[model samples]
Target: MSLVVSPSKVFRVAEVILEGGIAFAPTDTIYGLLANALDRRAVERLFAIRRPSGRPFLLLIPQEDWIEELGLIIGPRQRKLLSLGITLVIPKRTSVPLYLTRGRKSLAVRLPSSTAGFIRDLLKVVGVPLVAPSANPEGLKPATSVKEGMAYFGRRVNIYVDAGKIVGKPSTIVRLIGYRSVRLVREGNVPFREVLRFLSS
Candidate 1:
């Protein structure tokens, strides 16, 4: 049986994730299925649960520093874009496992905004980066509430951290081309034009 709890229960939530258990919780964007990024078994379980499309799952890092820790080099533009809550797909680093990236040449990553206190706290407590894909099975809409999350995952998910209805689109994703340019991939909550404007500024 899945345990449904509010975001206030951060310790319990961290316990589940640290123990290689998956959690259904609200993220900086939409609800996501979260697991320890470095735990291969845990990530395999998350893959089984999500039955995802071939595309790689985006990871959530507590801060920009984690980018290099994961073997990804962060440039100034990459830094600026991440600060705007955009997801970036950079050339893959060896540290990122093939299982997580699904054999892709690049990996998508995000540093959650400071406004996302629950996620920030959870990351700090868990003490590791997390693989966070929208909390939905392939071909289904993301759950906006714990009820919907529970309905979709049930006992498969260890905990459902309810923050409330998070009915928002996922973050905008862009591919970093070289030292200074970026190619828009998928535009989500952040507008592509705005991303361009920010880059220009």
Candidate 2:
């Protein structure tokens, strides 16, 4: 444990993240480590906490248009993917920090489609995009509840938001290699058939 916290104040937790602190909270998919994606210092701390150096984290934005804030473009299908709760690996902007993409020129991101109201509201307040990697040491199972995450991180994280139990599988990851050329990097919760249908549309 690092600092005393009030888990019930979601906005306060959001504020912590805004100030370069890492928080543990249930996301649209699972419990994850939340930090300001654009803050290199904060992001570096997140990498240290998550174990293994240089693992790419998915950025969680509030809206599809926000991707442009990082100097990337968004297409209709890409927007559609968000509606489907997909983690999109899109081409990265040159302006984005090397830390975020591990010196690569592409980034993985999503606009969280959380069913939980509090999570959504918190995301709304944060405004800035956040890196939401599953809350646990590297090579361990992703946490589905605050209790599960506490077991993994103890008090290393600044805040914890419990949305009961988040049992959904991880989001499917798709890489936009080329225009209209989408590739599956990983399959978890999203059905492949639907992806096919989306590609065909």
Best by lDDT: 1
Q: What TM-score do all the candidates reach, one by one?
A: 0.94, 0.89
**Can you list the residue pairs that collide in candidate 2?**
1-155, 92-106
Which lDDT tens digits does candidate 2 get at residues 75-138?
Answer: 6655577767788888866887788888777888877766645557777898888898888788
**Model 1 agreement with the true structure over 89-197: per-residue lDDT tens digits:** 9886777678878988788999888888788899889888999999999998888989998889999999999898888889999999875889989989789999889
**Model 2 poorest 10 in a row by lDDT:** 1-10
lDDT score for residue 182 of model 2: 77
> Whose TM-score is greatest here?
1
lDDT for model 2, please.
0.79
Per-model lDDT: 0.87, 0.79
TM-score of 1: 0.94
**lDDT of candidate model 1 versus the reference:** 0.87
lDDT of 1 at 57: 83
